[model samples]
Every structure is written in structure tokens, then in C-alpha cells.
Target: MITDPELDGEWDTAERAEPAEPLAPRERAAAAAARPWLWALGGVVVASAVWAGGLYALGDRLAAPTVAYRATKNLCADFKAQSLSGITGDLRKRPVNKEVSHPAVDAAACVMNNVPDSPGDFYVYVNTELHKKADPATEFDVPSVDDLANVGDLRTEEVPDLGERAVMTSWAGEQGLNLKVLDGGAVFNLRVFATTFSEKGGRPATDSNAVQAAMVQDVRELMAALRK
Candidate 1:
């Protein structure tokens, strides 16, 4: 108590302090160089996420079905008198399937009927073709639909209050009717070509105004099916 280590004079301040270590030039430079690369890598990762988000948002338009089983079945159901031979769907995304007789179709089908001298089944074509708005160059530029009434010498009429807009057409050249409906970004086309082939060559059956009337009714029913 009397000495008290001379009021703490024995405390060694020099022994408690340690010298600061200076980094080598090479190590300092390496750390400094890595900062820019790290920032760039983070930016790249963020950009990739943004791109993927855009694709996700546009998934339906990009991945829209080229053909579908349920779609074909519903279309075929619209026609009751004809015998359905078979149905098929094209699921390809690019370079759409083209046909000389009709606009490029996403699906194909064959139908048969009780027409004498017909060597083979006729056709029941369904196309969920791209709309004029979607591909303005070729979608609605269908030669068959555009000119069949005039070229085939068929009866034609505008169908009122049908699917955005619709047309009912009968082909005297083929003896069947076509109902073309334009809706949104797609054109729903249903056509039947009923021709008989014999020694006289391919010839259309007798014209019937009844067929054209029936097709218009069928198209209305088909619109209901599509809604469901």
C-alpha cells in the first residue's frame, strides 16, 4: 500500500504496441484488380435474370400450340353427317406446314361421305392458322380462301355476329363449304372438300344450297366449343 508500484510506473506501454504490417505491392495490386471483375460478374448475373423474366412473360405467344388433340376433336365434332377417317396434329414451331390447296394448316384430317364413284376419302381440314395481325405477310393471304368463291364459282356470304368476323363459302368446284372465322391472333378455318374421282377424273358433286346453310350453323356451334 505504501509503494503501490510507484503509481503504476511498471506498466510497459512499448511492449503492448505492435507494428502495422504493410502489404506487398503485388498483393495490393491483385486485390485492386479483382474489384472491377467482381462488379462486372454481378451485373452479368442480373442481366441474365432479367432476360429470363421476359421469356417467361411471353411464354404463351412463343410456346403456342401448333396442333392439339382436343382442338382437332372439337373441330371434327362440328360436322355430323360426314364420316371422319382420321385426325393428325403438327406440333412444329417454325416453318409452318404448307398445303397447295389451303393456307398453311397446323392440322390435317380426312373425312368420307356417301358419294358414289369417290375412289377415296375427302377432306375435313382444320387450321388454327396465324391471324393477319400476327403474320400480316402470309397468314390471311390465303389464295384458297381469298379466291375460292370466285375461282370455284361458289356461293359466298358474310356471317354476321360470328367470332370477331366470319365468312361462309361454298365451293361448286369441290361440292363442300368452308367457314372461316377470324378471332384475335388466330384464324379458325374449317373446310370440307368433297369431290368424287372416277374414270371421268376428279369432278365436284351437284351444288346444294343446303350445304352452305348447314355450314353456317355448324360454325356457330364450333364457336361454342372453342369457348369451353
Candidate 2:
């Protein structure tokens, strides 16, 4: 019934529509096969990245303990003297169990036991006296060379207390620093006994390398304070 050419073209739906070509079976199958593998590969990459990141984070936390041990070892090497004569007079006398005159020094002495024990059992002690001369206070005298040499028990093998798997020994030293290590609690099994003398007063010095090491170990601040 349409006479106009424009009207006739509009009325023919088939002329305006284009037919879609069917996808090849091979193409369709290839696309279907690739999708799952692509998703799986992406998942594996993500998992690997997460695992690597966790290890890096763990390593950072362990760094502090490692650094602390190294610092203590260095401190031992630095202040080691051939003879204990410098503080010998003060070391001979017995310690008076009193509150430490220098609390900071006492705290440092306590921390020595927390250091990891290796090679042999480690111990520390502090002895102190109160005097009006010096404000900061003084370290106890070191033992004489002869006395230190004579004392064989300074080594782990010589001391029976160290034989126990979890035995720690600590007492006040000639000055005001004392500490020791025993095998027990996570950290508490280790003990630190610190004494402080007035800069001019305290116990006489002794010649004991074990004692000297104890004093130096406490006051040395190579490592930061440990919580556990």
C-alpha cells in the first residue's frame, strides 16, 4: 500500500537488519580454555607476593635482638683490662646488702643476665657504698692480677653452680654491680644483684676476673633495655 520510496524502505525490517556471523568452534573453545588458567595464574602471583612481604616484616622484628647481642660482645672486648689493680682495694671487702646508690647502674647490672648465654654460663653482681664526695658514685675496685689468676673457678667448668641446666648465680660485687645467669624461666630465671657505694665508700677490691666482667657487663650500655 506504501507508494513513496522512503516509506517503502522504512517498512522493510529485513533490509535494515544485518545478520551476525557464527563464531568458529575452535575460537570459542580456545577462549573458554584460557579464562580459567589466566585467573589461576593471577592468583598464584598474588599469593607469592603476600608470602614475601610477611618474611620481610618478620626479619625487621628480629633485627633488634641480633644487634643487642653484638653490642654486648663489643663492650666486653673494649673495657677488658689485663689486671684488676685499678679497683682491687675495693673488691676484697664483702658487699653490704643495701639499696643501690646508683639505681641506673643497678638497672643496667640486672639487664646483663638477659643476654643470651653461650660458650659458658655468665654471671654478674654489683656492690656499692654511700659517700658524699662524688655525685654519680664510683665503681668497686677490681681484683688484683695475682688474685684473679689464682682463682680457677672463674671459668664455667670450675664452677659447679653452672653445671645445672637452669642454675643462675648472682650477688653484690666489690662495687655496686652484680648479675648472673641460671637456666629456668623465660627471663626471670636470670638474676641481677646490684650494690652501690658512696663514691668514697664500699667493700675492698678483689682479684677476680669473673667479678670484673660482672661489673663491666652491667654498666656497659651498648644495648637498649629488654622487656623480656
Candidate 3:
């Protein structure tokens, strides 16, 4: 029995306090290992943020190419396709044409139904796009087929001395040609289709070689006309 009440309370408090249990060896080791991983994860997050910020700052500069192409509404009247006139006859007074101008892109298209009176089917199409916002080089040469046009057997050939890159496409048993040219940020496409069943030889109105040559020649003139 203690005489002092204060001394007795102190003893009681000491008895009530149990020593805290130490963590298991495995738990301690796991905690130690996780500390480094947590730090690494934090570092990766910070680095990712910095990289994203940098990319956002350089987005426009990286995506846009240096080009001097201007949008024109007179693309239809500008291109005459004179070289093709011999095969498809003279151009009509009115050809279907469209033009669109936007901050990101400018587009112009012309479709001429040549030799309407004396031909079975004849068409000449020209389209030009000025990309003022993004580069079109990546997907330019990608292979694509038009199922609706029966273009499964379409073949492509490279044309030199035209632009940055040029490609001509033609299909088997088809008297037509598709030519695409890429110059800086400008994309140009020219297509010609002619099918006339002649009674004399039972052949198409235009041969493959003739169509190709005429398309190439007319496309050069078309490009020059648009540039002017």
C-alpha cells in the first residue's frame, strides 16, 4: 500500500501502457522497397508533364510545313486540259467546279464531261488542296483502293520532274488514269476516264498510253495555270 496518492496513479499509468508491437521483417522490407518505386513514379509523372508541355508549345510549328500556296476560285476556268482535248474533244462551256477556303485548308475542284455528244463516257477531274495547317506527306503514298470504282488491281508508278513527289495510278482493263502530285503543302490530283465503244475496232475510245501521256501533259499545264 502506498501512502502518496500521486505515486500510486503513476504506477497505474505505467502498468496500462503496453509496448507497441514492432513491424514484421517482411513488412519493413516491403515498405523500404516501395519507397523507391513511389519516388520513381513521381519522377515519371513530372517528366511526362514537362514533355507534354513542350509538345503543346511546338505543336503548330512541327505540324505545319513551309509553303507558298494560295487559294483560287478560278481553278475550273484556269485549267484547259488542252492536251486531252484531242482524245475527249473540246471542253464544254460549263464544267462542274467548286471552291472552298478555310483557315486550315483551301480546296478547289473541277469536273469536266468532255465530248458529251460524240462519246459513250468521258470525264476529266482536277482537284487541288492547300494545307495551311497540317502536313500531308505522311499519308500521301499510302496504298488505298476504291471498291466502288472496281480498283482492286490498281497499280501506281512514280513520275519524275513534276513536284516533290508524283504518282500515277491505272487499273487493268480501264481506259483511265489517276495522277497525284505533292509539292510542299499543296496536293494536286488529276483523273481522266474515257470509254467509247467504236464500231470499227470494237475498242475503247482512248488507249492506255495515250491517256497517260495526255493526263501528264495536261496536269503540267494545270499546275502552271493554278500557280499563276
Summarize candidate 3's per-residue lDDT along 1-228 as a digit string, tens digits.
546766566445535667878889998899898999999999999999999999999886677776656677777787787877666666655677899988878999988875445443667888898887788776687654542365466778899888889998876555567889998688888887666423223333556778778778888887776673
lDDT of 2 by residue, 44-93 (tens): 99999999999898774433221111111122233232223134222212
Clashing pairs in 3: none
lDDT for 85 in candidate 1 is: 24
At residue 64, candidate 1 shows an lDDT of 38
Ranking 1 against 2 by TM-score, winner: 1
What's model 1's overall lDDT? 0.50
What TM-score against the true fold does each predicted structure earn?
0.40, 0.27, 0.66
User: Candidate 2, overall lDDT?
Assistant: 0.33
Most lDDT-accurate candidate = 3
Candidate that beats the other on lDDT, 1 or 3, i.e. the better one: 3
TM-score (C-alpha, index-matched) for candidate 2: 0.27
Give me the displacement of residue 1 in model 2, in angstroms. Answer: 60
- Tens digits of per-residue lDDT for model 1 on 103-150? 433333323333333343344555544432233223443547445546
Sort by TM-score, best first: what order?
Answer: 3, 1, 2
lDDT value, residue 224 of candidate 1: 55
